[model samples]
Target: MLLFRLMSALLGYVVILVTGKATERFVNMAASRGIYLWDITRVREGAVLLKVRLGAVKALRHIARRTKCRFHFERRVGFPFLYKRLLRRKALALGVLFFLGALYFLSSFVWFIEVKGTERLTVPEVLGAAAEAGLNRGMPKWRVEPGRVEAALEEKLPLVAWTGVYIKGAKVTIEVAERVVPDAEDNRPSHIIATKAGLVKDVLVLNGHPAVKEGDTVSPGQVLISGEIPPLEEPPKPGEEQKQGEEANKPKKPSRFVHARGIVRARVWYDGYGEAKIAETGRRLTGRSETRVSIKFKGKEIILSGDQNIPYELYETETFVKTIPQWRNLEVPVELVTIKYFEMAEYREELGIEGARSLAGERALAEAAGLVPEEAGIVNRSLEEVQTGHPENIVRVKVTVETIEEIGAESLFKP
Candidate 1:
C-alpha cells in the first residue's frame, strides 16, 4: 500500500468530482476501459468523488462523456505539479545548486588541526613541525600524506619517539609520543639529610661518607651522609729529617666535595585516635524512587508525567530544570522541570561496649595506616583505650604504628 502511494505521488494523480444522472456508469465504464479509479464516494443523488491517475484523466473524459456524466478536477498532486512550481522560480534552483557546490569546495580543505598525546612538546611546536611538512590548517587534504607528515615530525623533533598523522573529514590529528630522556649525573657537593626524626635502623652508603651509623637516633635535617672528604696525610720518607718550619710553611690541602647519594632507613612511629558511640541513629535511603516531569510556561506549570502527590511519607526531592538557550537579548520563558523523589526511612543501630571498642580500634588503625608510606615495613601496632572517671556512652581508641622506612633525601651544598 505504501509503495503504491509513493508511485502515485511520483507520477501525478488527481481527485475529481463527478455529477450527472449516471455517475456510477461513468466509474464502471472507466474501470472497464482499464482507467483505474479509487475512493469512489457518493455525495448526493448524482454527485460522486473519486481519484484517478493524471495520465488517465484524458481517457476518462471520453468515458464520462459517453456515460452522460460531467466531471471536474478537485485537486492536482504529486511531483509533476511540484516541478512546475520549481520551474516558475528559477532563482531557488540556482541557490540550491550554489549551496551544494560551496559545501563541496570548502570540505576539501583542512579546517581544524588537533594534536594529541603531547607532554614535553607544546602545541605550537608540533604544529610548526607539521607546517614544515605541508600539513598546516587550511591546506588541501589531498596534498596531506600521512606517511610524509609522520616522518617529517620525527625528523624535526628529536624528542619525539613516535608520531601518527590522520585526516578525518575536515580535521587533521597529529599524535606524538616523546622519548624518555634520563637526567644527567650531578657531581656537585651535596649531602643526604634526614627528612624526619627517627631512630636509625640501618644505613647503606653508596657514594658518600656515612655520618650516622646503625642504632643512632637522628633529628630532622641532620646529615645522614657527608659530601666532604678530608685530604689524606702522607708518611715522611724514612731517610729524610722532618723540618717543623717547612711543614708549617706548606699550606694545607682543601677537602674534596661530591654529590652525596645513599639510603638511610629508620624506625618511625605514628599515632591516630578514633571514637564511636554505643548507640547510633541516622536516616538512610530505601532505594525506591519516582520521577516526575512537567513543563513551565509563563509562570504556569503543567504536569507531563508521574503523580501530583508524593506517595512516600518521608522522602527527599531533587529537582532539575532545562530551558532553551538565550541568544542575544531574546529569551524564551519556557522550561522543562524534572523532580525525583527518593524514599527515606529512619534507622538505628545499638552496639555493645565490646563491639564499639573493636570498631573504634579498627577505625583508628585504618587512619594511622594512611600515614604510613607504601614502601615502609610494618614492625608493630598497639591499641590503647582512654579512661575517664565519669561514666560515658562512647569508646575512644588510640593506635600506635611502628614502621621501618627510608628517610634520606638529597640536599645540595657548596663547600
Candidate 2:
C-alpha cells in the first residue's frame, strides 16, 4: 500500500467530483475501460467523488460523457503541479538553491580550533606549531594532515611526549600529553630518616650504619641509618692483659662520616573519615534539552528558529555566541547566538543504615587510598563506624589502611 501511494504521488494524481444522474454508471464504465479509480465515495444521490492518476484524467472525460455524467477536478496534487508552481515563482527557487550552495561552501573550511590535555605548554605555542604544519584555522580541512600535525607538535615542543589531532565538522582539536622529568639525585654526607611514623617491616643497609633494626617503631625525622661510621677497635692479644692506663695512652680513632644509602621498608598507616546522609535530596538533569538559535545585529535580536518560550520550568541554560570576523577597517555588527536549555528534576532518596554505611565506607577508603604511594604494597584495610552518644541522621565511617613502602629520606649534616 505504501509503495502504491508513493508511485501515485510521483506520477501525479487528481481528485475529481462527478455529477449527473448516471454517476454510478460512470464509475462502472470507467473501470470497464481500464481506467483506475480509488477512494470512491458517494457524496449524494446524484453525485460522487473519486481520484485518478493524472494520465487517466482525459480518459475519464470520455467515460463521463458516455454515462451522461459531467466531472470536474477538485484538487491537483503530486510533482507535476508542484513543478508548475515553482516555475511561476522563479526567484524563490533560485534563492533556495543559492542558500544550500553557500552552506556547503562554508562547511569545507575549519572555523574553530581547540587544544585539549595541555600542561606547561600554552595554547598559542601549540597552535603556532600546528600552523607551521599547515593545520591552521580557516584552512581547508582536507589539506590538514593529522599525522603531520602530530609529528610536528612532538618535535617542536620537546616537553610534549605524545599528541593526537582530530577533525570533526568545522572544528579541529589538538590533544597533547607532556613528559615528566625526574629531579637529579643528590650525593653528600647525610643520614636516612623517616618521613612518617611507622613500624619498620624490613631494613637493608647498603652504605651506612643501621640506626634502628627491623621491628622497631620510628617517628617522623628519626634516623633510620646513620652517616657516622665508628672506627673498628683492635682486639687484645691472646693471654695478654692490658691496663686501663695503657688504653688511655693509645691514640684515639677518628669517626668517619659519609653519605647514607639504604632501603628501609616500613608499615605506614593512613586514616580517613567520610560521612553520608541517610535521607538526601538533590536536583539533577533529566537529559532533555532544546536549542534556540538567533541572530543579533546592531543591538537588535531576531530569532531564526526554535521555540520562542522555554518548555521546561526548571532548566539549566548553556549559550554559545559566534560573530563574523573583521577585515581591515570594516566590521560586520552581526553575531549568531545559540542557547540550549536542559530540563532538571528534583529527587529524594532514602538510604537505610546499611546502604549509607556502604557509601560512606567507599568514600573513606578512597580518601585513605589517595595517601598511599602508587608503588606501595597494600598490606591491610579496615573500616569502622564512628559511635556517638546521641542519635544522628548521618553515617560516619573511618578507614584505616596499612601499606608497606620505602620511607627512608636523606638528611644531610656536617662533621
Candidate 3:
C-alpha cells in the first residue's frame, strides 16, 4: 500500500471533490473504466472526495459528464508539482546548492590535529614533527597518506619508537609510542656532588675517585667524589736519583676522567615543634545529623523533603547548591539547595602535665616525620619538652627525626 502511494505521488496525484445527485454513479463508472482511485471519502449526502493519478484525471471528466456529476481538483501533490514550485523560487534553490557545496568543501580538509600517548615528549614537539611529514592542519585529507606520514614521523623523531596516523572526518589523530631504552654507561668526565647538606656516614665509590670519607661533613653542591683519578706515584729506589729527573722529563701522564658514579649515605635530621594545652575546650561533631532539601524559585523557597527546622541548637551547616545550567543568555530562576546539619557537642578536657606532654610529643613527631622520605631508613627519633621559667598550662615539645639515605647525585664537570 505504501509503495503504491509512493508511485502515485511520484507520477503526480490529485484529490477531487465530486458533488451532484449521481456522485456514487460517477465513482462506479470511473472504476469500471479501469481508472484507479483511492482514499474515497464521502463528505456529505451529495458530495464525495477521492484521489486519482494525474493521467486518470482527464479521463474522469468524461465519466463525470455521463453520470451528471461535476468534479473539481481540491489538492495537487507529487514531485512534478514540487518541482514547479521550486522553479518559481530561484533564490531558495540556489541557497540550498551553496550550502551543500560549502559543507563538502569544509569536510575535505583536515581541521583538527591531536597527538596521543606522549609521556616524555611535549605536544608541540610531536606536532612539529608531524608538520614536517605533510600532515599539518588545513591540508587536504586526500593528500595525506597514512603510511608515508607514519614513516616520516618516526624518522624525524629519534625517540619515537612507533607511530600511527588515523583520519576520521576532519580530525586527524597521531598516536606515538616512545622508545624505552635504558640509559647507556656515561664515559664522560663528571663528579658526584652532594644534593643536600648532611653529615656523611659512609662513602662508596663505584666508578670514580672518592673525595669524602666516613665522618665527613658535606654541603650542598660540594663534590663527594672526584672524576679525575690522579696517576699513582712510586717512591725512588736508593740509587735512582737520576731516574727521578728522567721521570719528570718524560711527558707526565695526564689524569684520566670518568663519569662519576657513587653512593654517599648521610644522616639528615628534621625538627618540628608542637604544643598541647593542659586544658582544652572545643566543639566536635557527634555524628548525629539530618539533611534538608529545598527548592528556591524567584526568591521563594519551599522544602521538598526532610524537616523544615533543624532540631539541634548547636550545629554546623554543610550546604550544597545545584542550579539549572544557563544556556545562551537564558537563565533559570530556580535552584536545588541541600543543607546538612550536623549536631555538635562542646568538649572540655583537663590533661595533667604528663598527658599533655605525651600528646604534644606525638604531634611533633608526626610533623617531623613528614619531612623524611619513605625510602629513608629511620635511625633515631627523640622528643624534648620545652619548659618556661614560670609554670604554664601548655606543654610544648620539640621532635627530631634522623634518617640515613644516599645523597650522591651526578654532576657533570668540564675536564
Highest lDDT among the candidates is held by which one? 2
Ranked candidates, highest lDDT first: 2, 1, 3
- TM for every model, in the order presented, reads 0.52, 0.51, 0.53
lDDT of 3 by residue, 69-99 (tens): 9999899999888878879998888888899
Instruction: Give the clash count for each candidate.
Output: 0, 0, 0
Lowest lDDT 10-mer window, candidate 3?
A: 181-190
Candidate models: Cα lDDT each: 0.91, 0.92, 0.91
- TM-score (C-alpha, index-matched) for candidate 3: 0.53
Q: Candidate 1 clashing pairs?
A: none
Q: Tell how far residue 281 is off in model 3, in angstroms.
A: 0.7
Residues 1-415 of candidate 1: C-alpha lDDT, one tens digit per residue: 8998899999999999999999888888888888888888998999999888899998987888798889898999999988897799889878878999999999999999999998889999999998998887788899999999999999999999999998889999899999987555477789999998899989998887889999999999999999987788888888988789999998999888888888899999989888888887778899999999999999999999999999899999999999999989999999999999999999878998998999999999999999999999999999999887777989999999999999999998878
Error of 3 at 369 (Å): 1.9
* Model 2 regions more than 4 Å off: 1-188, 235-249, 329-333, 411-414
